[model samples]
Target: MDEERPPVVLVPRGGAWGEAVAAAARQRGLDPVVVPLIADAPPEDPAALDAALARLAAGHEDSAEDADEDGVPDGRHGAPPTGRTRPDAAGPGAPWLVVTSATAVRVVAGRVPRLPAGVRVACVGAATARAARQAGWPVDLVPDDESAAGVAAALPSDAGPVLFPRSEIAATTLVDGLRARGIAVSEVVAYRTVGTGDEPVVLAPPPDAVLVTSGSVAQQVVRRMTPLDPRTHVACIGPSTADAARAAGLPVHVVARSRSAEALLDAVVETLHPNPRTGRSS
Candidate 1:
């Protein structure tokens, strides 16, 4: 009998997202070891976040009342107390709630269970959009590019104020891009990405590939697991993350076509198994 192969992939992430990646790896016939390099925590200052949620909730309530008085039946529930806010008076149009990560979805859903009626939600990628839908929040837009600029491009030019809940160290691409387009945006730090200090354990045989999901994770991988072996492939989730890996002097073997768990796994498999016909990995 052949000796069982050692785990081939190392997932340096945490929580549900990490689990999802590991599971996908298993489906692809690769054993995965999860060693989270970073953890997410609520923002140090949640006052601003709370205040913004409150304002949105209040605005929703006002709109719900107006809709009732005008004999307009609530679409979700046709009744006097719609139990939902109306979107028309919120701004020039429904305020766009842009969520860039699953963490943002958790933060917003936990704080405000019910969003104001007519609030449009734009997610950065398919993963973030799925999280929003799972949290019972309707998603209006998901960009094909799966990046900050993608979210901005997907939004309407005359869109109302955008509420962006993101990580503390999030890049200004989306926020800056929207503002340059003459759109008012209120950005709040919903969470902070902090190092867990739990370094990846050195196995008898090192993992064949190490997954880097974010720029922060890339920094931690460099700090904790420096001097990585040349053979160890560094697979990044997207271009931004690949740039971070390159900036840290880590060799990037592959980058996912999209910023989803499945895509990440596909990138890894393609790197390990190049297609003979095209001389390229999927």
Candidate 2:
């Protein structure tokens, strides 16, 4: 008789993201049990966000120029004297819209039907970039690193004032980095992360592994689901989240190489099944 496969507990954000993780778990030969740890809702006060969006739109209207037939800047149509194209098409005055998460993109799109023209959109990772593109915004930059610090470093020195819309519990990484570089930053609380207040449902058989995707999720797990089994593996999505898990007294067994769902799943797989000969995941 075949041995029963151990189940993997996934603490994911509800909706499409959660469904995707369930599908990925099946492909990896792990039985998935979803326990949504946190939920997001728009911020209570919309006045500040509304005002910021208005200012950004107004700035664009005041400075934007018409693109040529080829969709290039009018004056700089051909290659320059050095045979190189200009780095940025938006003028220095255009506001830089930096989105670090898909949730942030959704919140911003709900308030502003269309993004202001000429505003440059920068995302922290491929997932956030896809969200912005789907919402009819053109992405200008995606840093090689998925963290806030990485995004800050990738931005041009002369990029204009940044408008960052994020969750209320967001870390200070981006804000601090941008301000240190002398760039003006205006932060809008786009959403709030709230706990469900319901206790986590106990699995018939405890999970073999538990995945932590965010710092808020880590906090909720520690608060709601205390006394985790020692044998269960705790996997984090990245370094910052791993730090949160450790701070909450969770024993982290794996950390993803990148901030993508695929990389995170890879970490879980390696933690659960190391290669026999090399004693490392293949």
Candidate 3:
């Protein structure tokens, strides 16, 4: 009899990626186990964020408006009254979203009473767009090249004043690139990524494959790989994540497209099945 096949393992580095991995695993007929390496929490100081939220709520939080009123570009403004809220379309018009993570979508949905119906959502990856869509908002652009830089470059010229509400620790490369390209952005810190700081989960041994999502996840996986098998296959979402995995000295067997669950599953199928053209074809 053939040896029992080793189970494919999934490590959803964080809550946002967990949602994607879980959905993708179900689609591919695999059982995914979530080893949450990190927790997403609010900022360390709630007072500053609370004050900002109050300003945005009070109708005077427009970055552009503040800039115009001050003549000087960068001085801080006094916080607006508490419990103030802005209209959904506060900017020039309905803005297109520039979302990089699923958490960003949920954060915005939670804070904004109701999203602007006419606003368009643009996501770096399919999973992020899916989350926004599930929340009943219109997702207009899901770029094939999934990254902050990619989405920034792919944005339509007509998309006025793009809104990017993302994690405080997220890379600023995308924002810088968009700004260099002359895209007006009103960015807000919607959430923060916190290291769980929990003792690493003990593993019996690494399975046949390990799925990795973000840089933080890669680092967490490396830290927790003490009981891991040396021969485990490593799969990463994209070039950035693949780089992280390589930095951990693991042989990366998969480099998924666009850092989405669909792409990761496709990469896994291709790795295990080995048909370049049609991964599942025997």
Which numbered prediction scores highest in lDDT against the true structure? 1
**Positional deviation of residue 190's Cα in model 3 after best superposition, in angstroms:** 1.7
Query: What are the per-model C-alpha RMSD values against the true structure?
Result: 6.5, 5.1, 7.9
Can you write out model 2's per-residue Cα lDDT over 1-282, one digit (the tens) per residue?
A: 113444455655668888888888777766677778788977888888888888777655544443344443332312222322326545344468999888899889998888876788999988789889999999989999888999888876656568899889899999999989877788988889988777765655667777888888888878877677776778898888899999988889989998877788877877777444433323
Compared with the true structure, the alpha-carbon lDDT of candidate 2 equals 0.76
Per TM-score, what order, best first?
2, 1, 3
lDDT of each: 0.77, 0.76, 0.63
Q: By summed lDDT, which 10 consecutive residues of candidate 1 come out lowest?
A: 73-82
Clashing pairs in 1: 60-85, 85-117
How does each model score on TM-score? Answer: 0.83, 0.85, 0.73
Order the numbered candidates by lDDT, best leading.
Answer: 1, 2, 3
Off by over 4 Å in 3: 13-31, 45-94, 226-228, 247-250, 274-282
> For model 2, how big is the CA root-mean-square deviation?
5.1
| Candidate 3 per-residue C-alpha lDDT over 1-282 given as tens digits, one digit per residue, 9 for 90 to 100 | 012332456665645557766767655644466777766787566465444445434432344444334222132333332232223332232245678888877777776656544455788787888888887777777777788778878875433456677788677867887778766666667788766665766655445567877776677777766446665668898887787778866668889866776788777766666333332223
Q: Highest TM-score among the candidates is held by which one?
A: 2
